[model samples]
Target chain A: MAQITFEDLSLSFRVRKGGKIGWKDFIVQGLRGKGQDDDWLTVNPLRNINLSITRGERVGILGNNGAGKSTMLKVLAGIYPPTVGKRTIEGTISSLFDLSLGFEYDATGWENIRYRGFLQGETPKSIEAKIDDIAEFTELGEFLDMPLRYYSAGMVVRLGFAIATSAMPEIFIVDEVLSAGDAAFQEKAKKRMNKMMDTASLVVLVSHDMSLLGEFCTRVLWMDKGRIKEDGPAKKVIAQYLEESRQQQAA
Target chain B: MTKAIAATSDYFTQIWQMRYFWLSLVIKDLRTRYRGSVIGMGWSLLHPIAMTAVFCLVYTTLFDVSLIEYAPFVLSGMTLWGFFMTVTHEASQTFLISQAYLRQNPAPLAIYPLRTTLCGSFHFLLAMLVLFVYTWVVQGFGNLTAFGYLLSSLVLLFVIGWSMACCCGILNVLFQDTQHLLQVFMQMMFYCSPVFYYPEMVEKRGMGWLVDINPFAACMELIRAPVLRSEAPEIQSVLFAGGFALVLLCTATCLLARYQRRLIFHL
Candidate 1:
């Protein structure tokens, strides 16, 4: 069974003044007898998160910008390890974030499909079996023969969405990838996401669309400044979240 | 101990499971490197071949050696040196180049270095084939038994290359100046090592100690003994290179284990 558990989880980043230090500064810092850690500013994106997500739950997260919603999803997706606590997860995880990021611009769309397939843990034979289906879903018939560099932004998203959602994931984690492409593609993408969510064992999604969350999620988590402010049924928590935001606007 | 072994094996298994992914990346690199070029991969060979020609012209006259022997010798040395330079230099950027994939998927970090090593090795192999044919034309085949040793040497060299790539890649990610530092260091190493001259020349110049301590000198001997002299590599040279490889492998493993989880922050 797919399960996720976070025990007292907290994550903090140590940011240097510059992104990196040069050798001259390193030697000077060493000779100055000042501790290296003193130069770093720590930013904590997650603090004291204790939660368990079991199988077969469609959970949605609602948070303002910088409220740690994406960070929580990344932690869940195993992209980041908790700094001071334990995170235990069972089952395969397929994360859909940065959907248009990792393509080889020189490679054709058909070849890119194979590349993405292999990255998602599909064998050659398996990808071959599903290649036709993914291609059909993209609706880019002759365009799939051209290199990715030649495709428009919308076409790239279409191809990315099709290949990413090709296989059913055991634990699917999505972050703000729904509102991609044109109006027609968004409608198709929603249908495809709904179909995948129906079969996926568990899914945790982060989105700004409260109506979308209300329609898809059974449970909702309202995050505020690195903490879960409220957790309840989707309707109740989203309603409360909207009410708070409205009050803040009025104030 | 058993737990350690299990973890090691599990790590390798994860790398193996992603073979298709990394292999595809390697293929893409090779394809794009020569795409739309008329000469194709010969472009990679041309640098060493041209360098060898120039060196042969200058060095044969200076040392009064025959062109036939010096040509293959310099070519072979240049080939191995080219491999070392390509792998370590390109591997330093492996993590940065694959940053997108790293953020998207949690695959083994070692595979990025492996991809760089494989690409470098492919070029090295092609260069070696040219060296073999040139040697055959000029001096016929070397000892078949000695040629067999080249196989083992290649394997050792591959491991060393991968380890160096891993170390350099991780270091470059953590320290932005690492690649520049490495370039300066490698330039000094090229001059110090017997890339264009014989190791015996260093000994004649009272630099015997340098030859004894230099791993690259030992590696040169390892390749030269089999191809030039038609003899097996001396056990001492093999042991020295092997010991260096072991040290580098351990260092790479330790670095990866310590930084694998935390590297994303640096990136």
Candidate 2:
């Protein structure tokens, strides 16, 4: 059975026109201005994105900025409901879309880890037992006791990644978080990701790192202008995406 | 329809999971607010005490209301008023202040303001501790009758705080200027609420109609009456606040569920 399915999902955002119109019409104009001749318009952020991933498939989404990679990931993670389609998801989902989202900067790293762990439904006893392991993974050392506000950006990323990856979720969605850390932390995160991949029923990663995608993903989805430009085996599809990017740049 | 049901269940489960995160956030918020101060958490009590002193001098010395009642009356009403204003003002800014947390993680948006409200409530708890000490020293700790009302008022304040937190939480997200607007509004509300002055004074001055409309005025009376006059809050006013809270909770849930995805985009 497919672990996740997104069927013809589409989302459009209104691009408001400038200047005012009629008082009554202005409010009624929905997305933008009313009868001032500028009217209104909408732009599709995600358009007809249909996909189905079976259990244990490591799929990487590749696109330039504004290509809807993040939006699609959010859709799959159930953060955004599609305007025009359906999503069928199975199993528990845990996503690390934005690295520093759940952490309290005033708290010690240890406290943040426990907090994030609990937010992902880990028991206090379980989180307590795993705190040492989580700290060791991040290599934050004694600084873990200090408030996260005092830590550097790289340290925040490392701690965030460590806490997020603590739980072995059934469906794991990683969105551009791996790009933040130092090389050593990156390698550690990569190892952790690989370990997760072995057990994760569905693993979806959205990133611009085509080379990394080539190295890790079994399949690649190339998105362009909110549409799937290509989907196939990782190397072949990514090559087409690169060619398309080059041609578009030349044009 | 089925998806909505599933999502509703998921929402509750998410809140359950995020409970610890919210608790930690409250602790962090409280610690950071008073971190570098020499007195630390004592500032919570000091703020109310200082405000009461200033108001006492102005209202009692300048005006005659303070003369009618001495320290106990002033302290009792001021304590409750301080709690109400502090909680409302803090909770109103909760969403705007915690933008970092709300944007970065998938934690429920409701939790951010909830943390602020909880932290504010916790501070109020600390202040109540100080209030008891002061009252004990002055009045000899003989008011067993008032404890029930005090407890009941505390519970009402909490319920009201949580309710306002949820409403103001979403409003702050939707309207960026809500925090600033609320600050000014709360300042205006303080004067109109009969906090330093008695409700009877407002009634005598032919502004009883104002008290009828002012929710915070009723809330303060609810708290003060129990503590000072040993009377329960008006059942009607309590019901009104409870109903208003229910409405706010429903509205917050709807806004949170609907626009929660777009909150990042707006930010």
lDDT of each: 0.88, 0.74
Give one digit per residue, the lDDT tens place, for model 1 in A1-251: 77889999999989897679877788888898768887799989999998888888889999999999998988998778899899999988877776656687878999999988899998999999999999999999999999999998778888888887788777888788666677798779778777876674778889998888998889999999999899889999999989999999999
lDDT of 2 by residue, A1-251 (tens): 32998898898765445422333444466565555445457768898888889888889999899998988887787666577988899987777777557677778888888877876778878899888888998898999999888998888888877777777778888889787777788778778878987785578998888877988799999898999989999999889988988999999
Clashing pairs in 2: A56-A201, A101-B104, A101-B105
lDDT of 1 by residue, B1-267 (tens): 899789789999999999999999999999888888899999889989999999998999998888988898899889999988976777899999988888888788999999999999999999988988887777777545687898889899999999999999999998888899989988888888888887888899899888889899889888888888788888999999999999999999999998888888888
> Model 2 compared with the native: what TM-score?
0.87
Worst 10 residues of 2 chain A by lDDT: A18-27
Per-residue CA lDDT of model 2 for B1-78, tens digit only, reads 899889888877877777877776677777778989999988887867787787777877666653434455666656
Native contacts conserved, per model: 0.62, 0.34
Per-chain TM-score (chain B), model 2: 0.84
Query: What is the Cα-based TM-score of model 1?
Result: 0.97
Per-model DockQ against the true two-chain complex: 0.72, 0.36
Lowest lDDT 10-residue stretch of candidate 1 chain A: A93-102
Candidate 1 wrong stretches, greater than 4 Å: none
Worst 10 residues of 2 chain B by lDDT: B65-74
